[model samples]
Target: MSENQTIYAAFAEKLDAVLSALEMEGTLPPETNRANVSVEPPRDPSHGDLATNAAMVLAKQAKSNPRALAEQIVEHLQRDPAITSAEIAGPGFINLRLAPHSWIEELSAIAARGDDYGKSAMGAGTTVNIEYVSANPTGPMHMGHCRGAVVGDALASLLEHAGHKVTREYYVNDAGGQVDTLARSVHLRYREALGEDIGEIPEGMYPGDYLVPVGKAAADEFGDRYVSEPEAEWLPLFRAFAVERMMEVIKSDLATLGIQHDLFSSEAALQAAKKPEAAEAWLREHDLVYDGVLEQPKGKTIEDWEPVELPLFRSTKFGDDQDRPIKKSDGKWTYFGADLAYHMQKAEKADALIDIWGADHAGTVKRIKAAVAALSEGQGTSIPFDVKLVQMVQLLRGGEPVKMSKRSGNFVTIADMVDEVGKDVVRFTMLTRKPEAQMDFDFAKVIEASKDNPVFYVQYAHARIRSILRKAAAEDLAPSDANLDLLAEDDLTLIKQAAQFPREVEAAARAREPHRIAFYLYDLAAAFHAFWNLGNDDAAKRIIVAQSAELSEARLFLAEQIGQVIRNGLAILGVEAVEEL
Candidate 1:
C-alpha cells in the first residue's frame, strides 16, 4: 500500500474488490448500494484485528442468508496472503486477523509519513466556514467563551487536517445594545481618568477594570473635548472607540490561548451594507416573511400585554415552535433577523457553515436553522449548516467553586485561566468531554501528576518515549526499522493502536467533533504504557535489551513511530508534546 493510504483504507479497498468479485460471479446483484457497509476495529478487541458488516448489510439485497453471504465473502478474503484468517462471528459479522507483517508495514508507513500520517483527504473539495468565540465586543474574553473557542479552533485545525479548505471566522457583535452599555461604562472610566470622582459604577454598566486602559487612552488622546460634549455627539464616537479597544483586548486574550481568526465580521458592517434589508425583502417576496401579530409571551404574567404587528419569518413552516419576528416594534432588526443575514452571508462564501455557540443560545437554534433551510431552498442549493452548542465550564480551585475575577468583576478571564494553567492544559481540559456536557475545571485536579489527568498522562507518555530514545542515542544506538522482523507480538499490538489514528481523524471530522482526537490519544497512551510496563516484570521484554541490539533497534523504531503519532495528534488539538517531563 502507498504511504498515504491508511491500513483501514487499504482493507476497505480490498473488501470492495472481494465484493466486486462476488458480483462478477453472479452471487450478488450488480450496482448494489453498499453505503451502510463499515470497516472498523471490533468493539471487543479479542474478536479480531478488523471487522466489517458487508455481508450483513447486503444480504437482503443479494437474496441470500447473511451467514451464507459471509461464508462466500470470507472465502475470497482468506485468499489474500496478508489476511491470516477470516472468521464469521455471531450472525454475519466478518472478523479478519491479519498477519503481523501487515501491522509492521503500517508502522513503516507511520515512520514514512511522519506528521502527515493521520491526515486524510476525506474533506477534499469542501470549503467550511467556522464561526466561533464571537463574544460580544464589550470586554475581554471570559471563561464562558473559552470552551467554545478551544472546541472551534481545534475543530478548524481538525477539518484542515482532514483536507478541507477552512475559514476561521469571528463575528464581532459591535452593533448590539451591549456595546452602547460598554460605551457608557468607558465614559465613566474616562471621566475618572480625567481625575473626576465618578464614584461607584452605575447599576447597569460594566465594572471591569480591564477597560481602564481604554478609558485612560481615550482621555489622553481626546483631552476632555468629548468629556463635555452632548450624549448624542459622544455616544457614537465612544462606542466605536471602546469596541475597537475591547476587540484588541479580546484578540490578545485569544492569542494567549494560541487562537487567531482569519476574519472578524462586524454586525455593524453587515447592517451598514444593508444585508438584512435585502434578506427581509427576498423573504417577503417569497412569502416566508409577512406582517403578523404574535400571541402573548408565555410563562410570564404581563399585566399590560398588547399585540403589535411585526414582520415575522414563517419559521413554523420549517419545524420551529413558532414564527419568529425579523423586526421589532421600533423598526430595528431583531438579533435573529441580523443573524439570519449573517448566516446567509457566510453561506455565500463557503459550501458549509458551522457555528460554535454557547448553550445559552440553545433556544434560538431552531429558528436560525429554519431560516437557513428556507434560504438554501430558495437559492436552489443544499448548504450543510450546523450549530454546535457548547455547555458551560464551572471553575474550581480546590474542590470549591472559584470566585469571580477582580479584573473582569463578573467572571474569570481567559488570560487569567491561561496564566494559572498553561495553554495546553486549558485547551486539552476543555476538550476532555463532549462539548454539550457540563464540566468542572478544577485547578488542583487538572494539574495533578497522575494517570487520571489526561493532559499530563498523554504528555508524559511522549516524554517517556523521548527519554527512551535519548538513553539509547547516548549509548551509540538509534532507531532502525531494518530489524522490524525481530519485533514481538506485544510490539505489534501497539502498532495496531497507533494505526487507528487515520480512521479516527476521518470519523471525527465527519461527526464534526474534535474531542475524539483527545480520547484516542488517551487510549493510545494507555496502550503504550501497558506495553512499557511489561518490561518491568521481565528485562528481556524491555525496549533496550542489551543482549540483543537487533531487538532493541526494532523496538526503538516502534517507539519513535508511536511518539510521532502522539505529536501529530497533539498538533491537531493545539497542544504541545513536551520532549521531556
Candidate 2:
C-alpha cells in the first residue's frame, strides 16, 4: 500500500484542497491559518466516520460565520468520491460519513502492507539522540534503573519506527566520586582475595557481593602485585579495572532485556578532551556565566551556609529559578557544568537531544534545559532538547511490596527480575504504564495467562489469529483471492481499529511516550478479542468458516492484519508477539 493511501492522510490532503478551492472562490480569506485544521475520527462514531474543523478555524479570518462557512465546506466535501455524506454538526464542525468501499479499500491496504502498514514518515530522517540508563558503573543495574532502561530503549525504537534516525546512547558516568568509591571497594575485596582478612566493608563503599568476582579476577591477573603498593599506584589501575568489569555486568543486564546502545559517552573522557573548559570559556565570553553569590536557598536550608563567590551559569535568564553554580568555591566543576559540555557536544552532532532520567533529577531539569537553550543560542542553531523523568517502580507479589535497597546489597537487580520472570515479561510489564507514573510490577500477574495481564492478553490476540491460520492451512484453505468487501460492519470496525496503529505510533514518538504504544496494542487486542468472541455465539463470524471458503479467507486476511499490527506494536516495545500463549 502506498503511504498516501491511509484514510486519514487522504482526507487531510483532500481537506487541504477543499480549503484552497474555497479560497479561490473567495468564500474563505486567502492564506488563512490552516495549521490548526485537522481531520480525525469524530468522538462519537454515530456522529461521523471523520470530522474536520477547517471551517471553524478559518471562519474568523474569512469574515464569515463558522456555521455558515461549514455549510459551504460541507457542500464541497460531499462531492468527493470517498465521502458519502457531509453535514454541519452543532456549530462549525463538519461531520463526514465515508463510503463503506473507502474503508474496505483501507482494510485491503492494511492487509497488503502487513507489518509495514503502520510505518510513517513523520520523523523524516531527523537525527534524534536518546541518552538513557547512564547508570553509575559502580555496581550492577538494580530494579531502580529498570524503568528508565526499558522506557529509553523503547522510545529509541519507537522513534526509529516513526522514521527518525535514532541513536541509542548511554552516558557512562565513569567519572567523579562514585567510581572512585567503587575502585576503593574493589581494592578491599582484592586484599581479602590476597589472604588479608578485611572483615567488613567500610562505610560509603559498595557492599554488593557481585564485586567479589572482580576482586578474584584482579587477584588472579596480578597476584599481590598491587597489594603492597601505595594507594595512588593502585587507584587508577583498580578504577579502570572495576569500571570495565562493572560495565560488563551492566551490559549483560541490558542485553537480558534486549537493550544495546550505539555509544557510551564517558564523563571522564569528555573532561580529558577539555569539553567542560571550552564550554565554560564560551559561556563566560557570552556573559552567560559570572562569579556571583546566590541568595539564601529556598525549600531546604543548607548545612554550611556561607556567602562565597563562585562561577554560576545564568540559568534564570532561560527560565530556571535561580543562577546555577557551574563551579564550586574549590575550583571543581559541578555536574551541571559537565552536563552543559556534554549537551553542547550533542548539539554539534544531532538536531535533537533527549535524556531519560530518574525522577530525582526533576529539580535539575530547568537548569539543563536552560543550558541546552543557551548552547543552541550561542551556536546559532535550533537544537530540540527534552528530558523525560521516569518515576520509581515498586516490585510486588500479589499486591504486597517486595523489599529492595541498593545500599544493603540485597536489592533486586535487573538480572534477578529477568531470571525470575522472562525478559519479555520484564520488558513488556515495565512499559505497561507511563514512566512518569509510579507502577507496581507484580510477579504473580505478569506471567499469568489471563486478560488481567496486558502482555499476555495482547500476545493471546496474535496467537488467536495464528490459531485461525493453522486451522485454515489444515483445511487446505489459503487466505487469498477473498473479497474483503464481504466483511461485516463489526469486522470492518475491527480493521478500522487496526488502522489506528500508524496514528498511534506517530503520537507515541512525537510525545516521547513509548508506553502509549503498549496501551494502544492492548486496546487493539481487546477489539480483536471481542470480534473473535462474536464467533463463539455465531458460527458464521469465525475466521475459518468451513461452509464458505471465500468468507473464511476474507476473515483470515482481516485477522492477519490485526496480528500484524500487534506484532509491529510489540516490536516497538521490544517484546515478542507469541504465537502460542
Candidate 3:
C-alpha cells in the first residue's frame, strides 16, 4: 500500500480482492453486486480489529447459507500476511485481527503526512456552491444567524479538505420591504445628525443604534440637503446607502467569527437584470406556470378575503402543498420567483448546490426544491441540490435566558457574543450539537475548564502533548521512530484511536454534517487522557524515562503523532489547536 493510503481504505481493497477471488474460482457467481459490502472497525473491540459483512450481503447471490459463505471468504482472507487471525461470528459476520505492525505502519503514515493527513479525494472533479449566513441587510448580525454561519463555513472547509472545489456564497436580500423601513429609520437618524432633534423612533422602524453610524455617514456625505426633503426624494438614496453600509457592518461581524464569502449576489441585481422575467417566460413555454387566482385563504371569512389574478407556478405538480404565485397582483416578482431565478443563476456555475437556512424557512423548502427539479429536468442537466435547516440556538447566561443587546435593542448580536466568550468558544460550542437539534448556548458553561467542556478538553489534550515534547527537549531526549518495536499494547491502543480520523472525515463529508468531526475529536481526546492517566500509577508506563532512553524516544514519537492528528481534525472544523491552556 502507498504511504498516503489510509488504513481503512487499504483493508477495504483487500476485502474486495477476496470477493473477486471467490468469483474467479467459480465458488460465487460471476459479477455479483458488491455495493453493500463494507469493511470497518467492529462495534465491540473484543470482536476483532476489523470486520466485514461481505458474506452476509452476498450469500443470496452465491446461493449458499450465510455461514457457509463466510467459511469460503475466510479461507481466502487467511492467506494474506497482514491477517493474523480470521474468525466467523454470529450470522456469518467475518472478523479479522490484524498484526500489530499494521497500526505501527499507520503511526508512521501520520508522521509522513503531517498537515495533509485525513484529507480525501472522494469529492474530486466536482464543484459545490454553498450559500450560507445570508442575513437580510437590515441590521447587525445577531445570535439568530450565528449557528448557520458557523455550520456553513465549517462544512465548506470540510468539503474543500475532502477535495471538492467549493464556492462560499452569501445572498443579499436588499430589495425587500424591510430595507425600506431601514431607510426610513436611517432618515430619522440622519435628521438627528443634522441637528433636527428627531423624536423617539416611530413604530415599524428599526430601533437599533448600530444603524446610527450609517445615518451619521449619510449625514456627513449629504449634509443638510436631505433633511427637509420629501420621502420619495430621499428614500431611494437612503435605501441604497443604508443597505451598503449595513452589509459592511455584517461583513465585519462575520469576520470576527473567521467567516468570509466568495460572492455576494444581490436580489436587486437579479431584478435589474430581469432574470425572473426570463424564468417566467421559460416556465410558461413548458406549461409549468400560468395566470390563475388563488383559493381563499383558510380560516378567513369571505368578507375578509378577496381573490386576485396572479401568475402562479405549478409547484403542486412536483408535490408542493399548492401552486405558488410567481408574481403579486401589482405585477412585482414574489420572493419565491426571485429566489428561483437566483438558484438558477447558481446552477449555471456548479455541479451541486447546498443552502444553509434557518429552520424558520422550513415551510418554503419544498417549493424551491420543486422549482430546481423542474428547471434541471427541463434544461437536461443533472444538478444535485439540498437545503439544510439549522434549528434555533437559545442564548443563556448562568442558566437563565440572556437579555437583548443594548446596541441592537433586539436579540443579542454576534459581535457581542464573540466579544464576551471569544471566536473559538462560540464556533466550537455551536457545533457540539447537531444542526437540526435545538441547543442552548450558555455563556458560563461553555468556557468552564472541566471535561464537560468539549472545546477545552480537546485543546487541553493537544496542549498536554506539546508540554511533554517541550519538557523532553529540555532533558535532551527527542522522539525517534527507530525504536518503534519498543512501543507496548497501551501505546498501540492510542494509535488505533488516532487512525480513525481519516474515516471520520470521509463519513462526515458524505453525510454533510460537520458536527461529527467535533464529536470524533472529543472521543479522541478522551482516549488520550485515559492513556495519560496510566503513567500516574506506574513510573515505567510514562512517556519519558531517564534510564531507558530507547523506550522513551519511541513513546515520544507516538505522542507527537497523536498530537498531529488532533491538530488536523481541529483544522477541518476551523478551530485552533492551542499549544497551551
Candidate 4:
C-alpha cells in the first residue's frame, strides 16, 4: 500500500471510532461503519483542506439534524493530532484543515516514490489482451485509423502501469474479399510496370499508385510464370503476395507514430486451407450450425442481395436481433463465420479481450458480445470482451475541414499526418479527448505553443522544472539534500497536488480512459506555473535563492518530484517528457 493510502486508511479507522463514541453518547447511530466515508478536497478552497459526507449520509439514519451531527463529529476529529482543526458548514459537511506537517509528509512521500509514485497493483496478475487498429491489409493506414491506434496503445500502457499483464494484438483481415481486390489492383500495376498501357483503373478497385512497388516485386518473382494459367491458379498466389507486400508498408506507417503490436493474428492463418475444416467441425459440435434466411437490411442497398436459406448461427438465442447466416446459398462461408471462429480461438487462449473499433461498427457490438457469451457457455470469464468505439477525427487546417478522396488518389495517409505535425503532436492531440467523443484535429492549433495545446503545456512544465533544478545546482545547493520541513505554502501546494498522482492513475485506469491522465497533468502544470510566477514577485520566495540551503533543498526536492510526476503521466500517454522542449 502507498503512504497516502495508508494515511486514508488510518483516517477511516479514526472516523469509525468517533462514530462509535458518538453513538454511546446517544448522538448518532450505533451501527454506522464510516468505511464508505470519503476524504477529498473541496473544489472551493475556502471550505477547508478535506471535506467528508459522513455526517450528511448518516443524518436520516441517526435521526439527528445533519449540522448538529457535523458539529459533534468535528469536535471528535479535533482530538486527532493529524487534523489541526475542523469546521461544520452548509448543511452538515465536516471540513477539515490538516496539520502543516501532514502536508509536508505527503511531499516526503512524493520525493521518495519519484517516477514510480503512481504505479499500482490493482490489476494484480490478471492477463488482458487489447486488439485495435485491425484495419484491413489492403492499403496503408490513413487518418481514420490514427486515433484508435493511439487510444489503444495508451490504454495498454495505462493498464500496464496499473499492474496488469497486457498484450497488444492486431487482427489482420488478410483472407477477406478486400485482399482479393488488392490482388487485382496490383495486377493492373504489374502490367503498367511492364510497359503495358493500362489507361485507367477499373471501377470497384483500388486506384492508388502506392501499389506500384508491389507490382514490381510481383514481376520480379513470377517473370510471366502465371501469364497463361487459370484465374484460380494465379489469383491465390497474387492475393497472398499482394497482402504480404501491403503489410510491410502498413508496419512502416505504424512505426512512424511509434506504435507497435505484440502480436498480429492473421485471418488467413485462422482460415487456412488446413484450418478451415477444423473450424467447421468446431462450429458443428457447438450446435452453432443451422440453416436460416436473414432479413435484408432495410436502409442500405445490397448488390448481391437474395432471398435464400443457408447455414446459419443461432445468434438470436444469444440476444441478437435475428440468427445470421454463416454460409451463403452458394456453399461458401460468410465473413461473420470467419470472425466467429477467430473469436473462438481468442476465447480459448486469453482470459480477457478488448477490441478498439471505429464508431461505424456501433451496430455490431451487441451481436459480437452475444456471440462471445454463447460461445463461452455463459461464463463471461472465458471470453470477457469490451469494445471501445472511437469516434472519427475530422482533419482541419486554419478552421476549415480538409477534404480528400481515395478514388482520386489524393487521400492523406497516417504517414502524411505524422510528417506534418510530428508524432508527439499527433499522439497528444489524439488523446486530449475521450475515445467516444468526436474530436477535430486542426493542424494550425495543435502546433501552437499555448495552454490550448496540452502537449506543449505538459512538456513545458517538465522543462521548467529542469531549469529550476539547474539553477539550484548553480547556487551550490546539493540536488539531493531534501529537508521536506521547509516546504510550506506554495511549495506545499505543489507537493500536495503531486500526491494525487496515485489516486488519479487508479481512477483513469479503472475507467479505461487515458484522457483523464492528460487532464490531470494539465491541472498539475497549472499549479506549478502559478508557483513559478511567485519567483518574479518575491526574491525570498524563489526556490534557489532562499535564505538557507535547507530551504533551497526542500524547494528543489518538490520541483524534482513535480518533474517525475509529469514524466510518468506523459509516459502513460506515450508522449515524451524532455528535460528541455
lDDT of each: 0.94, 0.88, 0.93, 0.81
lDDT of 3 by residue, 75-160 (tens): 98999999999999999999999888899999999999999999989998599999999999998998889999999999999998
Can you write out model 1's per-residue Cα lDDT over 469-500, one digit (the tens) per residue?
99999988899999899998899889999999
Cα miss at 263, model 3 (Å)? 0.7
Q: What ranking of all candidate models by lDDT puts the best one first? A: 1, 3, 2, 4
Candidate 1 overall Cα lDDT vs. reference?
0.94
Ranking by TM-score: 1, 3, 2, 4
Greater lDDT among 2 and 4 belongs to 2
Give the alpha carbon lDDT tens digit for every residue of 46-144 in model 2: 997889998888889889899999988988888987888999988889999887787777877876777777788899999999999999998888888
Scored by Cα lDDT, where does model 4 land? 0.81
- As for candidate 2, its clashing pairs are none
Clashing pairs in 4: none
Of candidate 4, the 10-residue stretch with the lowest lDDT total is: 1-10
lDDT of 4 by residue, 1-581 (tens): 24635344446667778888988998875676555677767778767677788898888878888998888898889998989889887888888887778777666666667667788888896788899999998888898899999999999999898988888999999876788899888887877777778887899888887888888888888877665567788888899899888889889999998989999999888876534455556656778766667788787467767778877777778888887776657766677777777777777767778889999999888777776777787434556788899999988998998777453286778888888888988888898889999899998999898988888888899999998788777778755534676666777677768767777887888888888998899999999888888989998778776667888777777788788889999888888887886
